[model samples]
Target: MLERLLDNPLQDPSGYRQRCFEVKQDAQTDKWWLYVTYCFPAEATARSRDTVVGVDVGVSVPLYAALSHGHARLGHQHFGPLGKQIRNLQNQVVARRRSIQRAGRRGVVDKTARAGHGVKRMLGGTEKLRGRIDRAYTTLNHQLSAAVIRFARNHGAGVIQVEDLSGLQESLRGTFLGGRWRYDQLQRFIEYKATEVGIEYRKVNPAYTSRRCSECGVIHEGFTQAFRDQHGTQGRSARFECPACGYQADADYNAARNLSLVDIEERIRVQCA
Candidate 1:
């Protein structure tokens, strides 16, 4: 059936199938979704031990990545000019959509009836604009994933640790902004690229990583710069002081430490079991 569908491809089919790619039926959505897989030999020697990598996912910059060896900072490019360009394109798409809706409303008010053809044409234009934005986003995601792979290979990072935000969509319901973060998309790209390079990926619970002080294990509920500067005077920037020991570190680096610690605990549990 899939082969037949592929044989007579539609102009814009919901999805398609091909070798090295699978569109499996899953519980999340009723229809099948696409996934591609690639396999390759490991680059490192058998004697080279594993090094852990930590990743922090966010909405502003998308991803922040680090490794234990300090060889590279993956996903830094994502926060610069390219990211601004993508955001601008997305904003244009949103404005165009709103304009189309307003135009439809005006047509009805002026003509005492909806101008169906005009409304359809306006919506078609919005769709084309949306397609361009989506393409840009897809391209950026691919670039970011490639950068991550290169960083891992250069740093000799064998394992990648990610926060388990599996049910984030449901958990964020009724919040200020829901279903806006593309965490699942980023995760899928990371997993696929890592597997292609024979790198191990793991997810751990993201509890108290950003709140607890990395040096002293002190839990500060709102551990922001304002709190740190007033209490411990840890200077400006992403660094914070432990208040107990005056140990200073970058905020993201501290979070990464927690992720690594949790990963080590999980590994020990698995070995014991």
Candidate 2:
């Protein structure tokens, strides 16, 4: 399988190094198999001469990129729904296991010869359901990551800025950021892909990205946090309406615009010295 993918003439393999081999057991198959990891040279792509994009990532929206001329939302509309499905299925599986264990512990059921077999079958079914849910989410995450990298390349962006979400996920479990495991996974994909293509990646302090007015730089002190739904209505979610400048936009987009200015601010600080 690895050999065919690498040797495919239609795929570009010029800038990549020799494939590194590894043997691992796949979760789906529970069997050992050989795998090849592909790598790329650092300078495979020449750096772009212009453009910098700020990507504001959120639990609700996933990503909102602020570009030079306009903006784009990364990831698919169904991503949120799919995530909900995965999480719900996960919870259901846990509950199902607990119920099965409780049944096994009861005096009436434990005496039956079929008890052990019945519990095993129930557990197996739950495990299979959870696996399918996880696979769906994994597929979606890969797509989101690829879309973000492509967005940067297509825009001729020299730099792609993302928030440092290190501790935030731990702090926001149960919320959108609660899926820290998968969110971080997607982030790593974007980071490496961007670097491999010669686009610099950076992380900025996300503290005030949402609260500060993107138009005038005034911190709203306490702006109402809003959300922009799939239908594009701000009233449905957390939002920011800057009282100082009366600039209204989705809370996440406002953050993205502010994030986009991080590179400019850094350059000014450097020149002043």
Candidate 3:
């Protein structure tokens, strides 16, 4: 794959753009790696616009893509091992930093001259941690975005829809994922990649997507956080039950399904009125 993708623009300047290369060292492995970013002209796809693939960005799932008209889906288990790895890295960094802080404070408490190891070391450690976490997020975005585009192509979908999350940052104020800006980054990756392959990418209003039933268009007001707590379905619960129509499915997937509809916003307005 590397050989095929890395085409020499000088040798074959037909359809490839000038490639840019970056050299970086891995924070975990302390090994240098080279990354090449290249763009190649892609032929416009002949797929019809009848099929719309809706992608849902979530906390635990990362991404969930589904066809608007069919049950075809992708990215169900994309976050399993990879998401755990990111969380574990974050926890370790936080713990170690706290330990460093505690150790630094002990010298002042004991009234003894201490080795000034904490300040400089903490800065260095933080830089390394930031690099590692950023790299992990980039990797996750690349993987999930590729999966979304591949799913659309496999099903010959011409249009791809995602939630408009301009206001999600405020809601995500207390979360690590939100702090890292992963949700919008993931959507951007999908958008550019899909556009490169002649797929129309669009953002839809996200109101009531999670609570509205995809089948019957009923907005289940009972599916709130309190309802989830009452039913013990909080904290990454996969099940979403519509109280009105009894439509049940994975919550993220169901949201993706509703997003696939071009008329989702209009449906919500009509239903609520």
Best by lDDT: 3
Query: lDDT tens string, model 2, 22-58?
Result: 8888785596977677665565555554566777765
Candidate 1 residue pairs in clash (backbone atoms < 3 Å)? none
TM-score of each: 0.66, 0.72, 0.77
Mark the regions of model 2 whose C-alpha exceeds 4 Å error after superposition. Answer: 1-5, 8-13, 26-28, 42-50, 68-113, 170-181, 224-235, 263-273
* lDDT per model vs. reference: 0.60, 0.64, 0.74
Clashing pairs in 3: none
Better of 1 and 2 by TM-score: 2
lDDT of 1: 0.60
- Residue-by-residue lDDT tens digits, candidate 3, 32-134: 9988776766646698798999987653455678898889887546557656665675675577678667656754566533345555555567666677767
* lDDT (C-alpha) at residue 253 in model 1: 59
lDDT of 1 by residue, 1-273 (tens): 355445635423323333366778855235577876433344443322357777765323445567665535644354566566656755776697697778778677766434766776677777677667666667767766666667666677777778888776764332112255455776788887887566887888766665556556665566753453455422223455576677776565566665655354454345345
Error of 3 at 194 (Å): 1.0
lDDT score at residue 67, model 3, on the 0-100 scale: 98
